[model samples]
Target: MNKDYFKLTGEKINIEDLSREIVSDSKDEEIKKELYDELVPKLRELHAKLFAEAKYGILVVLQAIDAAGKDEIIKYIFSNLTPQGLKNTSFGKPTEEEESHDYLWRINKGLPKRGEIAILNRSYYEDIISPKIYDTLDSLPDEIKNDPELWNKRYKQLNNFEEYLDENGFKVVKFYFHVSKDEQRKRLLERIEDSTKNHEFSFSDLEDRDNWDKYQKAFEEMLNNTSTEIAPWYVLPADNPWYSRKVATLALIDVIKKINPKFPEFSAEDKEKAEKIAEQLKNKEI
Candidate 1:
């Protein structure tokens, strides 16, 4: 199935192409209204099937730059997934306890059990992408102090982790929300200028913004290294929130569609037993 939201490695999609197809301008309010109307119900139906199947779990990892609408996309796509069948985790800097352990320890603890869908807001890619780009190497052991091959080794480790998950019946779908720097600047400014959104702004966000070029280079490298047949990364367009949500929802639904587990078929003996029970209840008053 051609599940790409926007092609990153090949000919990339234009902002206007995504905007026209995914979301019209806020001036055209009808697009958002219509898209959401169609979105929620269809997602709910997929959730019901995904929940009932009970054989496999889906791990959805969303990685995005600041103001790329990751939070908004999560809220919309998972609105209908039952709480029992779903779990959402947002990763941040390691706590003291988390810091004491290996990098994978915190992330492995967040994995979903069978028949559940776990949404990782930002995932272990931070271990590979963030530390390398930001020079957060103070925590690394002395053995790997300045090794040039450290990144390649980490990528191999990630591939092994994903391979293990796939063998154990977990489907990992990772998304990289690709927003242009200009678009990110616009959204950040919107938060800065509006009093209501001021609370969402952080000093660290600005620091990250300053290293925008470095982060993009890191992201490009990370995606190229980690994009495997077992666990593919979908580079999603994040310039339009409405369209992003729709695309995410559809991508998830498509994955769930592959696991087509119907309610079990009844045998002749089972049918006979049910018939006997039904005949006994026929005399009861409605």
Candidate 2:
């Protein structure tokens, strides 16, 4: 995947200008499969190295509309990672404690420790997008709720927070799964009709779908305002599950490769002790 086509770092993004289906230049399914097959093992290897190095952390934030395939993409691409090194958190409706805190408080608590990879299925961005569309700002403080510049202020806060993470050795990668309205409807219907997926369907999903245009505007503003050099957003064409998975996988691998985590170097004393222990093992000493 050409990362630039999907990346929105320091660029104004118009969701209308982006395709929700596979781009014309996207690779065929065969090529996508081949690339995916190659990338997964490489990602696993990098993730292991990252865990051992304990020098950097990775935070992957996934945001999408209903039935945009966030769950599927995360499962397929990241489930291969070692449980010890990877943490996946899905943010749904906030709990009482969470609701009492600032929107990013739960998100902060979920951030990865050094040398770990944290995947957020839905994140603080939801605060901006969903609430903006639904006008569900009653829970917020009056200053934030009533401020005309609330969205802009929130964007600045997010940018500063992400920059702080970056400066503190956490690399942030965000994905916006861009599924078409028709595709989303198709998937939502499948959820209702497919027995195995019935549990995933809810009346609220349909209600949210009714505000699709509003959500799109909110998403576009979110992407344009918050995509920065430290934490860029990738808008994946999500109509084709296979293609989106491949793109997401490739994007992650690209970031990890850039991070270039490695096994920690041993100190002189540690190396001497390791050699002694190695010699003892070679001699079959208990």
Name the top lDDT candidate.
2
Q: Which segments of candidate 2 are over 4 A away from where they belong? A: 23-32
Query: Could you give me the TM-score of model 2 versus the true structure?
Result: 0.93
Give lDDT: candidate 2, residue 218: 89
Residue lDDT tens for model 2, 1-286: 5768888898886789998887443555675666557878888898999999898999999999888988887677788887899988999878888888888898976799999999998999988887877777777889779999988899999999999999999999999998899989889999989999998888888888999999899899999999988899988888877777777777888888898888888799999999999999999994
Cα-lDDT of candidate 1: 0.75
- Strongest candidate by TM-score: 2
Instruction: Give the alpha carbon lDDT tens digit for every residue of 85-109 in model 1.
Output: 8888999987888877788999986
Supply the global lDDT for candidate 2. Answer: 0.86
Off by over 4 Å in 1: 5-34, 263-286
Displacement of the residue 44 alpha carbon in candidate 1, Å: 2.0
lDDT of each: 0.75, 0.86
